[model samples]
Target: MIDIIQPPKAKQVLKTLSMHDDDRHDDYFWLNDKENQEVIDYLNSENDYYDAVTSKYKAFENTLFEEMKARIKEDDESVPYKFNGYWYIVKYKKGKDYPIYFRKKDTLENPDELLFDCNVMAEGHDYFKLAGLSVSPDNTMIAFGIDTVGRRNYTLQIKSLITDEIFFDAIESTTGSATWANDNKTIFYTVKDEKTLRSDKVFKHKLGSSTSADTLVFHEEDDTFGVAIYKSKSKKYLIIACYSTLTNEYYTLNADTPDGEFSVFQERVRGLEYSISHYDDQFYIVTNADGAVNFKLMKTPENTTKFNNWTEVIPHREEVLIEDVEIFKDFLVISERSNGLNHIRIKRWDGTEDYYLPFDNETYTAYTATNVEFDTKTLRYGYNSMTTPSSSIDFNMVTKQKTILKEQEVLDSNFNKDNYVSERVWAISTDGTKVPISMVYRKGIKKDGTNPVLLYAYGSYGHTIDPSFSSIRLSLLDRGFVYAIAHVRGGEYLGRMWYEGGKLLQKKNTFTDFIACSKFLIAQNYTSPDHLYALGGSAGGLLVGAVINEAPELYNGVIAAVPFVDVLTTMLDDSIPLTTGEYDEWGNPNDMTYYEYMKSYSPYDNVKKQDYPHILITTGLHDSQVQYWEPAKWVAKLRTYKTDNNNLLLKTNMKAGHGGASGRFEALREDAEEYAFLLNLENITT
Candidate 1:
């Protein structure tokens, strides 16, 4: 047993890791032995201590959870989307933590046929997730994937839609996604390496086939690459793609030809990246080939998809990064980013009507949504901002008309967009990069430095964290807190150049960019350092860990959820799930250059005997992406060196994985806990 504030001091077991002529000592390495009883005991002790520390907020946490949950329509049903011969729908009942998947034929007036009730399946499991729901083309059977252990090793299962019998077919150790061939009986899925958990193989199975008899369709030999299985949008080809952070290679086989051998559409080339979409007799390729760093759209005859055959359809733009494209029978929907804002452009096949979708907010996210039908004149999309609820929309391409299918209903009647103000601002970084910041707050909040502000950023993996509405975020606004998102580098927010500037050797740009944003916010009187806070999850967690290490006096507190703080060790170990494939992302530590560069900012390795801001570190016991030990080891090491008496806490979810809790309502509880941690630090209690 240990005191609430004095966490159980982890017994240090010195372990040396040598690479690229360098040796590093990791004292908390013993925490990595998860199978040992002593290790489990240590984790349990920490959880108990965290529970004890947060016990006083039990009532507040519950209230916050219930308040957020109340904003959700418990009996909500998703708008039906037509596919094949049925209209698919997903609904959640009151008091249920899972969804019931259903479908109806011909009309919404017909009785719904229950496909799967996740609530029942999730019973008795501490963690459960259902995904890869693919109905056969013939609509006779369904293939789905489920994971209960939270490790993301989904078990693929099939059920007879006609006989209503759950088949004995099960494929284990998959990535939780399946693609069906046009034959409806043949299904393909990706499998991960048992040790690294890299999706390295693609397997195909026939209907009612035994798991032992599944055929291995493809195996990716490169440890730096992971594989994925998917069907072309046109439903004509089964696609197998192998990719690393820097490269992409794809192979295709006709969907109707189950036994046919796959042929490469484009051979692998270093620094070349392309994505394929089939339409008519041609394959539209979005590629960064020929030094088009911003990416360009190219079309080639389906029979010859090589580089030489590619003809430019949409030339690359220096300022705009083409993110994605959704193709229809008569239209091409382009998703792009420019000046740190997302825009959706609609261009007709004949190039007669080309225009951008109009949006009012300065910092909102608008992108292509579900568009299953290819022969339609209407386009479906999603739009949301910090002050607006997410909306599902249908835009008529011919008439230029707009119709809102549904806007997420926030049950809180007191919530109003008019009461909030959102805008885009910029922060000049040390290198003169004008970092964009999307901020929101209660309209009447003073621009005086007295306001409390929570600045969030995730600058990694070229994944942009767009500005969107969150019903839960309302609690922070109502409590007089300002929320802002730092559009820093390592993300493709401004363009491809933004991401290139923040990865590999330039990775420090991400941390500095975030720090610059914080300084700008304070200088502008949005909030002073005394009332500032930082928040990020996963890689963003890594961002907070790094930034606070470099600029400890910039914040009052930080909440890092499932953070990847132990960078050097995690990235150097090929046995870790994401290590090998992240070489291009973080750079291969096998090289001395990258090794030394990563050690410069590796949070755990750089922890010094200095004062640190208040930190709340969280992880899940079964996290597959960033293992739980990374954070556990980080917190233990931080406790050993930090001189400050600031509230340092660690909370680990015993049942969840990378994404935390699987249940919808259950996840809200964790959010409430995080919000409560921030609120309590500021002495704000309603």
Candidate 2:
């Protein structure tokens, strides 16, 4: 057995926070000063302690990493996607960490044109990401965004595809995407606020012009709103979209008119959420207007885009949630979710034929993928389940023929889909709501209550955690572990109502639902409290933190990755990134009712002296969405308040941001460390 090393104790400088007649004392608030030398020292000390405790199993961690990495086909390439007049493909050479963007003109037999080799571009940077590779309509110029610090603030740059020379025009602090006007020389991009990193302004830039001369096209004056620029799929209009949590407004300009003023599509109405897509002469809208809780599809003439002028194309159904729509010259494809499974429905423009794609899996994810060409009858879609490898398919709407473009290849010779089983089970919450749990395990594993089960969940932001295949997860399944995902509230797993029940005043439902699922697993003999583990990241990290605070005895170990646990404090500070925009999801604490409610369940504020499960927490120093300090302060408080001798470790990625390490192999190492932590607790160190 590895000896537990003494953890670092952060010095507590008493800081008092007051709101709505409530007073809370924070001791580790001093750790929030990222620029302070003492703060850096404390974080480093914690990391050092984590290394010391886990050093005994370092070899095992590397072994787990190699085991996971061996399953990947290293020299992999994404399925070719055709856009404009070129067929574009992203490929990675053997042993390379980054992708090489390639293209072919006219036909697949043509010689490949090298667009960008990211490995060469990322030579000197510790962290690198390429985003928004937009090719001009004329196909000679390309605009892309690059981020080296992982804070998500990308620098926009343009390159001449023919000359292979990068232009002198470089714009900084952008959201990393540029929407080109039909003129090809003019582009519109969004810039973020310096401190908060909120995308608030849209600027128009012309080729060969200094950024100082760029015109501010629009500014989102509301702090709660963010703005982004994009061209419609039809490529007829450039759009500037302004959105808050509950409201959306869009401005459109004809693609040919680069200097023309943009007209608002529809006036913003509170609680009304909508998205727009362009067809031939009309605009297709998917919205939750007129009390359509599940949302419906509507169409309005492009010249007159207003709510009153919109006509219903697809009526809303209570059981079905219209997630997205793809426009084609001859057909319209709608992505929908019913119960907890995704369905793709195809409809011809003349309304002569309409049908849904068949899926046999009880729990799987299917969605539209890279359908950039609007004139084709073939629809590109992706499919995968808990046990099935992902496959990209092209389905013909005319003949109902399907072609598999490429399927994920698990390089392990011993891996087989038949060796594993996946199913969906419902767990009844305290409020009588039936929550779904998607689980997968080895076929021979018995429900003997001795199995180690990892319950994972991300119950926030209306983002559903669908059951998808992961080659790395074979390490656990092959070792007799049952992996499960609790479809809790705060996510749109069951529908919009499920998310509504888990946010704002009802946020506690997200935590309780996860706890209920854990208990249900225990009662079913799939796992016991001694063998059950929990895992979540970001908002999901908030879920596990709140869960352990409510019922720590139920879990043997917990892994919180980049957790947003400092709720009350973060919500009260609007200057923090994403806090103002998140008021609708998590109520603004400036209000008295929200202040009291948030204080009641805030993970850091509610830490008490009690025996807790072994915990491993991770954070990235440059994380912009959830600042590094939130997790740092959380770990400090957990160490101070918890009375258990169980392992409590904090591992911070000093150079990376919220997404963690940049290289594919480096990411596997982090995952291996996490799995090692859990396995070490079970004493499975082999």
Candidate 3:
């Protein structure tokens, strides 16, 4: 007789949650106690059960991991960009999991100056992330943030570039960024609330001083808003920006006067959203003022930085969304999206020349990259597509000449862009809206409803998942899997209106659009339900979760990573990280209307006595964004409510956070595990 591996059973304690005259009985609520030994044991058991179930395919998983890792150029280095008379470069040594930072002074021919070797600093830590590398104006010191536990709360530290010695100053619970003032000794950074992890305070710290002596420059008292400090591109002012989902306010201070009070550039307005970029004597603003849904470009003199003084520079277009603008000494480059495609438009400051850079690909991502030098005509940009590798290019605005600085190198010798085919297809949603789907597969794929397809979508927060190159995804395409990205309504793919149509009361449009895409694929003979799979992570994970609950039969299997399954409960609790701040995104559940609507589709609450597709859920215990308990409780509830005995597994990474793994190669292992789960569902073990 064959032995069957049994899954772990979580013991549930009944807990009643009451909100707005509504009561909910939560059986697995006890799992939310992070310090509870029972909770830890239950989580460990789930991990053990996942290991036992996948032990048979360990070799295949390793093979997949190696195959994906082999495609990465081990000793890869990023394109160097010049800043403060030095060229900065980030490179990884072969077999190392972390990056090494280097710099060349004056010229590229100069000997490389070793800044930081993350491999050495990451030693003894299972999870490590270094962020916010800010060099002092004098180029004698550097401020950076480090996180060892992967919770995103970093410790800000300063180091002497001249002496190669780390300073004694250290500030904890920061957002992992520090902006330096012109006076190299002073710096400004944002600090997060310990409980909610919200960036609520901005502090000014002076070098050679204790953190306790630091001054609080600004406090974002509104629970719905967060604050951040950044230096203007012109390097003349330090700005503190307070922002919420639909509102924004900014305070500015001359960088030379580190101790001076910051003056408010604009007062807060409930529906006003704007960002500032400093030029010679004016501030360029990208805003949705005057009901500009897609946003418009406006400018105000530095001396008169107020709404009344703002004048339009670029009018808002119904079909286009102004994503960002980069200011140069002689030009302005605007990043816009129109009809789900990226457009880079360069305009001369004197209004003499205005035109857009041309792109031929039907489905590709292109955007302006780091252009630290304000005096240059060269615009550095990045471009990639589903079938093409990513390339960093520099285009001279004056000469109309472009140069490819560096292209992503795929280590596999057999890899070729022509071997794959990518195309855009439209799916008619239930609401009669046409949603776009970008799909890539092997060139010889046949639309006979027999091939395997992985449909993915992240329909939340107006975050568009563009069609971009991914060498790692080649493992799936090469294995005869068709990967498709459903540009649903919740994202800003079409325009700001597309995102508006899928959020709050209309959030169901996101799920329906994804379902429409899957059905369209099946109807078009690309893949049938038996060979279709669903995949999403975080908000995207929530997408797949709700998807399976509404139409489980549409997908043969599903993968949800760090899913926000318990939506209603999470939104109701302001104490949860990102809860209060995201009230604008996911409506405040305190209101009865939002509460009822949220409960209607929340993945955990909707799980009932019905058949479900084979599912593999993954989460990180240290995930601050979407708590591990969300997924843990979700899996427990599904096991009890789901009628089918399809594979239902949960794997928790105890060492990492929202992002699964910190190391480049280690992250591939997580991807391999996920891909293995999907491939095994198709009986494609190798």
Task: Put the candidates in lDDT order, highest first.
Answer: 3, 2, 1
TM-score, prediction 2: 0.99
**How do the residues 338-360 of candidate 2 rate in per-residue lDDT, one tens digit apiece?**
99999999999998999999998
Candidate 3: regions farther than 4 A off: 1-3
Q: Each model's TM-score?
A: 0.98, 0.99, 0.99
Task: List runs of model 1 lying over 4 Å from the truth.
Answer: 1-5
Clash tally, candidates in order: 0, 0, 1
Q: Kindly list the per-residue Cα lDDT of model 1 for residues 476-532, writing each as its tens digit.
A: 999999999999999999889899999999999999999999999999999998889
Query: Which candidate do you rate higher for TM-score, 1 or 3?
Result: 3
Candidate 3, residue 434: lDDT? 97
Candidate 3, poorest ten consecutive residues by summed lDDT: 1-10
Overall lDDT per candidate, in order of appearance: 0.90, 0.93, 0.94
Which ten residues in a row are the worst by lDDT in model 1?
Answer: 1-10
For candidate 3, write residues 486-559 as lDDT tens digits.
99988999999999999999999999999999999999999999999999999999899999999999989999
Alpha-carbon lDDT of model 2: 0.93
